[model samples]
Each structure stands twice: as C-alpha cells, then as structure tokens.
Target: MDKKEISHSELKALIGKSPDLLLIDVRTKEEVDKGKIPGSIHMPVDSVDRDLALDPAAFQAKFGVQKPSLDAPELVFHCQMGRRGALAVEKAQALGFTKARNYAGGYKEWSEKAGK
Candidate 1:
C-alpha cells in the first residue's frame, strides 16, 4: 500500500466523481485496443517522459486530455499490471507531477474486480 497508489475500488469511486482527476493508461497501442478503463487517456509508457513535458495545449491535443499541472492531486496512471504504471508515476514525478499516483492493481485487477 504505497501512499502514491490507489486501489481499484478507490479509482472506481474517483471516476466521474472527481472533475480534476485524470486517469492515464500507459500501455501499448495494441494492448489498449483490446480495452481500457472507461475515461482513461492512453499515453504509452515510452512516451511519457517526452509527452508530459509538452506545454498544456500541445499535451491536450496529443493526448485528448488536459495536461495535468505539476501538482495536480489526482493524476493517476495505470498499465496492464502494476509495474509500468509505477514507472509512469516515477516519470511524472520526475517532471514535477509530484502528486501523480499509480493504480498499482492496474487494469487486470480493475477488470476482474468490476467483472468487466
């Protein structure tokens, strides 16, 4: 239970309820084509370090989601399992997204827990 990690149940509750929150899914294009958590913006893990450095407008145009501010409280990242998501969090924080968090259970737990 890392302080910067959110559980599936917590993420489910945050969806739609937290207007300031951004759900980021860092997975391969092919993997995401299968499915992702509803409302998640797809930004691949490899591109995170590059893309997150973009200015706000450019970031939004690229990712179709608002570029999270450096300190945005609910910038949550997830992947197939937990590892890549955690890596994404590290990248985000390195770029000053200090509050970025990992959905450590990732999509597998999310799908299973939600019976998707």
Candidate 2:
C-alpha cells in the first residue's frame, strides 16, 4: 500500500483497529511534554532529518525499532496541527515506510474525539 494523507477521523479509526500500529508523534519533545495521544512513539520530525534522513536503516538500528509490518496498521504521524505531521508523513514515506499518513488536526482533534 502506498502512503497518503489521512484526516483525524480516519486516523482514529485506524488506531482502533491496530493498537500496535506505529503512532508517531512528530512534535518536539518539549511540545509533547505538555500532552500527546496515548501509545504514540516520540519520533521528533527533526531526528528524521539528522539521522534517519541520511540513513534510515542505520537510524532504525540505533534509535528505531523494526518497521511496522501490517498493511492496515499505518505509521500515523501527528503534531499540534496537520502541517508538521503531514511533512513527517512525507519523510516517512520517502524513507521507505509504505503506509504512512498524517493526522490532520492532530492533538486538538484527538482530544475532541475523546470527548465525544
């Protein structure tokens, strides 16, 4: 499956189906320190540029785990809003992640979903 953009509702549905899906928080550590969706991996967007951008295999060997293998289990990226997370999804796809998607509306959208 090719990577593509995903909205908040779509991302949420994916999360429900695959709990072990790689939920990547593309926000900075400080930003995420405030709060983040549960079970997300902290893969700062910058880190991908430094190491993973240069050599993803090496990055995985050192800082990342094996790429998630489920087709429906997407590599979902989210930040405060959609832009950064959308960029992160593009990077992840460039780095050979076949199932990456952005969580547009991100944390704010997620919080709203939880309330509903």
Candidate 3:
C-alpha cells in the first residue's frame, strides 16, 4: 500500500483548498482538551478500528460526522506527536480510505508554527 505523509504547512494549505478533506485527531481525550488543530474531528487512535468498521450511516450517527468514502479526497490524522497519527493513518488505509495520510509533525509542530 502507498502511504502518504503531510507536513504542517502542507496540511494547512490543503485545508484551504480541499473541501472534501477530513482532519482527524487521534489523541487521547485529555490531550485533546488542551488543544487541537481547528476543525479536526476527535477520534482517538484506539477507537479507529472499531469505529471505521461500522457502516457509513452508523459511523456518522455515532461520530456526528460523515464517514469518509473510500475515495474521499483526503483524510489526515494527527496526534500530540506523530506515532499514533501514523498508526491511525495505517488503520484508515487498511479500512479502505485510500487517500488517508499522517500529519507527521502532528500538534507539536503545528502549535509551534501556528501558535496555540
């Protein structure tokens, strides 16, 4: 499988350009309470497999957001650092989200460059 990685700046640019993009925060709830990239959906890494396994309608009902289609334009995952985000992206891909990617810099680099 082809894995993709996005940098902070690239993700910011894509956010502006891609209407179909889905930004997922795979951090713990406590970590997420501190802060996160604006507009990111909070889906902890640990829940990804179970959540993505649900059918699209059920997934949306549970998460309050549309389930990304297999051909969704882009789905970017991030965590406090990068490891969990990479894992989340892999899980997304395994579940057939072909456009999934890891935001390698994650929230740490984002906060540094974009401010808290």
Candidate 4:
C-alpha cells in the first residue's frame, strides 16, 4: 500500500499537534522496557492485524488519536530501526488511515536525540 513517510525530524515536529496524531511503537514490550519516547503507544507489528480485526475502535483509542476529532488519525510508526516501521506504515495505510508515516530511523534516532 502507498503511504506518506516522514523523517525523524518531521515526526518530532508533528507530535502534540492535533486530532489523531498517533505515535505507534512497533517494538515488543520487552524492547520498550529498555525505554520509549515519551507519549508513544506500544503496538507491536506482529499483533497489529489481529488486534485491529477484533476491535479497531479499542485499538485505535488506546494507541491512536482521531484526527480532526473522530476522523482519520495521523500515525507515526517506529521500530528498533526502520524495517518494521515501514511494514507497520504499510499496514496502517491498508487499514484506511490516510496519514500514516514511517519513522525511518525509529528508536535509535530517538535515543540519539535524547542523549543530545
């Protein structure tokens, strides 16, 4: 599926802006246990399809914010690096979200920024 991918800097800027700007971390809880970017929601890529199928609303609510209020949510998906994030972004777009973006550098970039 086609998607609009955003860089790390672009994503950092987009955070806390509006409606359904969701920060979706595609790493496992164990990985996240190491640390996660503040305000990010955990939704491992493996479970996304099933979870979305069972209860899209609940999944979206806990992990996503509705864009423009109950409208399409902007998604920023990340992983250890960028591979999984790209997959997640594709999945999100297939699910009908128009604003999904892949955080190509993922947590590594996040950690680097935090160090700075």
Q: Top model by TM-score, which number? A: 1
For model 2, what is the error of residue 97's alpha carbon versus the real structure, in angstroms, after optimal superposition? 1.8
List per-prediction Cα lDDT, in the order shown.
Answer: 0.91, 0.72, 0.87, 0.73
- Answer with 1 or 2, whichever has the higher lDDT: 1
TM for every model, in the order presented, reads 0.94, 0.72, 0.90, 0.79
Regions of model 4 farther than 4 Å from truth: 1-3, 54-57, 60-73
Which scores greater on lDDT, model 1 or model 4? 1
CA error at residue 31 for candidate 3, angstroms = 0.5
Give one digit per residue, the lDDT tens place, for model 3 in 86-105. 99988988988888899999
Predicted structure 1, TM vs. truth: 0.94
Order of quality (TM-score): 1, 3, 4, 2
Best lDDT goes to which candidate?
Answer: 1
- Candidate 1 per-residue lDDT, tens place, 72-112, comes to 98999999999999999999989988889999999888888
How should the candidates be ordered by lDDT, best one leading?
1, 3, 4, 2
When 2 and 4 are scored with lDDT, the better candidate is 4
Q: Which runs of model 3 end up more than 4 angstroms from their true locations?
A: 1-3
Kindly provide the TM-score of model 4 when superposed on the true structure, using C-alpha atoms.
0.79
Estimate the overall C-alpha local distance difference test score of candidate 2: 0.72
Q: For model 3, where is the 10-residue window of minimal lDDT?
A: 1-10
Model 2, position 90, has a per-residue lDDT of 74
Residue-by-residue lDDT tens digits, candidate 4, 1-116 = 44467777777777776544677789999999999977788889997665545465775576564322223456678898899988886786677655677888889988998799
Worst 10 residues of 1 by lDDT: 1-10
